[model samples]
Target: MSGTLHLAQALSNRRRRGRKKDFRDAERLVKRLVSQELTLSFVPDGEHRLWRTLTRTRYQRTRDKVRLQNQLEALLEEAHINLSSLVSDLLGASARRRCMR
Candidate 1:
């Protein structure tokens, strides 16, 4: 349960190494962190993690919806329907009604 998270550049910049180099590094890093000496990383708390997950999922779903709408428009064009030209949004209620004809 006790360990250190170090940046690659920070680890590479340190010049000291021994047989227990990795363990020593972890110890030093933890000490620095506990004393507020290490300030390189910002590990987010649970609320921030949840917010990030929700935002990413919303963004991905919006992208997928737009992609699918574009594909549907392309299919309509192939059949000489020209849905994109007639309506601002191919997925709109008005457009759906027109397509149902």
Candidate 2:
């Protein structure tokens, strides 16, 4: 029973080490890919051209345009606009006070 338990622990330790090595290798691959950057290329084959045309037509429709516009409007609604009026007022007041001195 003791020997079996020791063997099981050894197996678990080996599995853990193997998983750690695999994770390190994956991290290295990701870092290399990120450093090199990435791009998508569409080769102008017959099938690719057909798919591209279909995609473009789908996106160019009025309904898709309306949907995209609505999405943009909703996103802009959630964004905060920072006005420069207050900042300009403060700077102008400081400059005027400095000039008077």
**Each candidate's lDDT (Cα)?**
0.78, 0.50
User: For model 2, what is the alpha-carbon lDDT of residue 90?
Assistant: 21
Best by TM-score: 1
**Candidate 2 clash figure, as a count:** 0
Best by lDDT: 1
For 1-101, candidate 2 gives per-residue lDDT tens digits of 35211111222222323445777755654554456432323347689889999988987886777777566545644664222322343235664564366
- What TM-score would each prediction reach against the true structure? 0.71, 0.22
Which residue pairs overlap in candidate 2's backbone? none
What is the C-alpha RMSD, rounded to one decimal, of candidate 2?
22.4
- The 10-residue segment with the lowest total lDDT in model 2: 3-12
Query: For model 2, what is the alpha-carbon lDDT of residue 66?
Result: 75
Model 1 TM-score (2 dp): 0.71
